[model samples]
Target: MTNPTNLTPSAFTGARRVATALAIGVLTGLAQAGALEVLVLDKEGKPVPDAVVIVVPSGLGVAKNPPPMAAVVNQEKMQFLPPVSVVALGAKVRFSNNDAWDHHVRLTAPGTAVSANPASAEGMSLRLEGKTAGKPAYSAVLTMDKPGATGAVLLGCFIHGSMSGHVYVADSPWTVKTEANGIAVLEDVPEGSATAKVWHAAQVVDKTPQTLVVGSTPAKLTLQLDVVPKRRRG
Candidate 1:
């Protein structure tokens, strides 16, 4: 059992680090296995990868939750892997450090998304900032925590200001992180109008949730969004 004293402010920051580190590395395949095709496009009509698309039942048909899936935001050589991740709400996220040096992880409340490169209409990106509240829960080894308190969690290491990552926890279980090809497959959805929300750290969140129909023909959504240059993996 965790001691109450360890839950103090200073100790909380330490505990939070361990929590984030364990769940930071395993987001590449975290989307639900599906067949409804999800296509994302830039203003010029190119596939935009790394953009997460969420679908919630619009009462058109019954929607069921998949098995609980945990996620990771791992630290390695001072870089966060996958860079971006999508998860169902109330999902456990583990944060682990695999680097030779110790690192401090921090999170902020959800921020509104705005244009990062209004003229540059290509690439995957998001520039988010939230009103930070409370000290981070930290620990020595690896630790685990859920992204239940925030809309989107922005991660950065205090020790290494340059290192960063984004974890998007969706309110619904039906979410897909677009692949390199900018395709998110959502399957078994009830045919009719379902609400779809687009998430990008850099783009403005002015998009009105669009209605999507998951019928015999796959639903293809073309979103004209401003883009940022692609991210370089460390």
Candidate 2:
């Protein structure tokens, strides 16, 4: 369920992205790739599910796709499956009501795009001047004004107040949602050093980037997070 407070559009005001597609492609094509295993735990060291983990190389750029990576959120039995979704910025999302009755999906969040043109990928410039700085790109939400779009929106059934779900729009291609076991595996990482980031709807921070190094063998990382859940709304 999505709490009405704590997470709003104004959050991610300091976030930015650039040349995201090329960066993901290059990282995908790395010759010597390794796996990055992530373990997420709460401040109490309890497993936290649905947390997002993203890795950005030290000298690469980040960008979001137009449709938010074709992510889908389904409503069945008056509940949302995969309760939380993670998508890249500018990605497109789909909402479906599988319940017998009708349900309305709404997403409320502040969204902005730094790309020269939100719709034109060619028009999207990194301002990198052909430099691979490997700086971590920040993320902000994007409104779903078009059909089948999803970003930072509060999805709910106007009729069923108990129904709630959320979608996260991120900037990096290396992002994944933590499973129930608090585990996430990032594969094909080039053997080198990179920056690791954790993002969730409940927790916000000024800066908390960790260093990750991928080598011939797989690496394991345990991340501690606070379970500051927002109160349920009526």
Candidate 3:
């Protein structure tokens, strides 16, 4: 072992240089990573929850928190428990009808106008029998494997026109659903330029994507939709 008091001047200087280099390296690594806090609002300036926020960095990057590969959407009280969901492309989505009455699951591509007869619509359709006492609710799993099926899928019921929901298949891994406060935080983003896109179920027209820069420091952005979202039933 080297004695501390007998250390030479040159040895002390070498040790100090190594320590400084290590500190600089750590800072450079941190500078390469960044974070963003996104807020979604309506035209009325009110927070819009359940909105999908996707961040695409200019450089090669991976999502620190990618969307789930599998999810379950339950039909309860004549409505989908989660009105909106975000999942990875080619994910498996399970639809379970927990209600006592039968319900039909109709899925259509985003931007497809609702047809007068939902059953006649062009998309995947299935029927789930009502749940019985002491038995598990009927569920059907559908894989979103269609080519170019990377956006929102409109969910509705043929028997109950009032029932509606959405399943968003994210093309990018850095996708998140805003919380009740209309906030979505994305971390571990590559520092540099990136595009941010927001999607809401109630928006008839898609909003334009916004460009922003990410640096060592955290950043915040606010995106507003053209229309206010309708409140979901209790």
Candidate 4:
């Protein structure tokens, strides 16, 4: 290394310029991204959990946490373990029956009329046998590859009409599910304008998406559904 005391004036100026450029670059990168906090509420003004929140940035910003490409939904206590799930488009979802009794997995597009024969529905169908002692639970996997199946798909069991759930196939990587506090936090979102959309199982009709601006500072938004969702069974 060169002697510090013998450094020339030009050398010091060059070092200063390099340092300034690096500092500016870091600040610019930080300013280009931000975190968005979204809160979902029902028509009754109660915090809504399990809601799907999607942020479509105007600039092609990459998601720090993309939706999962695969997920598992379990059948337990005569109900789907997770009543709602958010997955990336073309995701493969596994349906596992943990109960001692057999269960059928019926998937159909939202707004599709319930058919007398669920097996004959337009979407896919599978029958999962009940789990047996000393053996793993019966499970089946289905790929949501259909082009038209980009949104929420209704999940049910023909044997048990009371069984209901949903699988939301997200088109954007910035999709997230609201937590128990009814908040969905999206990090590293590109700064600028973005369209925020909220989807709930109870909202049969889609709500209008809201437009907002994201900046270096954290941003908060609140979206409310038109209908109150029913509480899930414990």
TM-score, candidate 1, is: 0.64
Every model's TM-score: 0.64, 0.61, 0.83, 0.83
lDDT of 1 by residue, 17-49 (tens): 877765552332222222467777766677777
Model 2: per-residue Cα lDDT over 64-179, one tens digit each:
22114566666666776657887655555656555545565544443322222336322121111111235322222333333333233445555678877766665556777888
- Give the per-residue lDDT digits (tens) of candidate 3, residues 133-154: 8899999998876666688888
Winner on lDDT (1 vs 4): 4
Stretches of model 1 off by over 4 angstroms after superposition? 1-35, 60-68, 112-150
lDDT minimum window of 10 residues, candidate 2 = 123-132
Relative to the true structure, candidate 1 has a C-alpha RMSD (angstroms) of 18.4
In model 4, pairs of residues that clash are none
Give the worst 10-residue stretch by lDDT in candidate 1: 114-123
Report the Cα lDDT for candidate 2: 0.58
Taking the candidates one at a time, how many backbone clashes does each contain?
Answer: 34, 20, 0, 0
Which lDDT tens digits does candidate 4 get at residues 5-102?
78899998999999998888675463477899999999989999999999998875568898898999999999987998998877888899999999
CA displacement after TM-score superposition, residue 41 of candidate 2 (Å): 0.6
Provide the lowest-lDDT 10-residue window in model 3.
112-121
**Colliding residue pairs in candidate 3:** none
Give the whole-model CA lDDT for all candidates, comma-separated.
0.59, 0.58, 0.86, 0.86
lDDT of 1 at 227: 64
Report how far residue 125 has shifted in candidate 3, in Å: 0.4
lDDT accuracy of residue 115 in candidate 3: 24
